[model samples]
Target: MALTKKGEFWYGTTSGDTQAELRSYSVANEHEASRFAASKCDCGCRTFALQSDEDAGVAIRTCTDCGQEHLMGDSADHLDDAAPETHECVCENEVFELMSGVSVTPGTHDVRWYYIGCRCVECNLVAVFADWPCDAGDAAAFLAKV
Candidate 1:
């Protein structure tokens, strides 16, 4: 029998849109990588892993091995978990900036990137966000106390 490659692995760009640790290929196959991408972001911007190669470099949430990609980040109103996910995004766009609001999602942790709003040519959109807190309790307190 030929050696059977019976597993899933994923590879991705080392560059992230957020300030969190730039996640590279974590597993041996594609399946796991897709899972990792869907599990929210460090900056609360949600993730959907992509596979980029030299030819088709940097497609969104796309897997080069399986040719399957996920294109997300249009909406900004869901919390899947409390892992304190943050967002890394492009500096320029047509609409809003930041991820969420400090009021709705207080700046609890030091390990997050507060969306300071963006300078779109036509409009500057301000969003809200939060992620894994450098001080989880302090963040929670700030959210609760005020």
Candidate 2:
């Protein structure tokens, strides 16, 4: 199946209604998207702040309530291997909502690019943390893994 918009979130921009599109090739809706984003923190908080580095293919999720960070997604191993520094919002808060976008081949639906974004819950700042080229035959599975 082709990727579809599952949710919408503000991306801290004045351009194009200041919103970013969240698309999933597998998940069906916003609620499912939330579940796929991350699991509940040990502190019992389901919310988190997210950051990613495409160069390393690493995505980190920090618990909003307790500030515990977790390496997540299919590329998590890459992040673990690199051991690069993590990110923190300027407000010193570690809460964020996630959004995603993708580009695909016209007919084959092969994912050509993937982007992950986060909106800081505290300051409402939005950033595109990870975006990279993809050449997956199964777009849905690729997205789910990410």
Best by lDDT: 2
Off by over 4 Å in 1: 1-59, 75-104, 107-146
lDDT of 1 by residue, 1-146 (tens): 11122233111222122111111111111111111122223334422322112121111232223434332221112223212222332343322222111212232242121111121212221221222211222333332211
Best by TM-score: 2
Candidate 1, residue 135: how far the Cα is off, in Å = 24
**Which 10 residues in a row give candidate 1 its minimum summed lDDT?**
26-35
lDDT of 2 by residue, 1-146 (tens): 22222244333532121123333321232221221232456777756766667676667677778888776545554755554445666667666655555566666656666566555667665655556664545456555544
lDDT, model 1? 0.22
After superposition, the stretches of candidate 2 with alpha carbons farther than 4 Å from their true spots are 1-46, 65-73, 76-81
Residue 38 local lDDT, model 1: 21
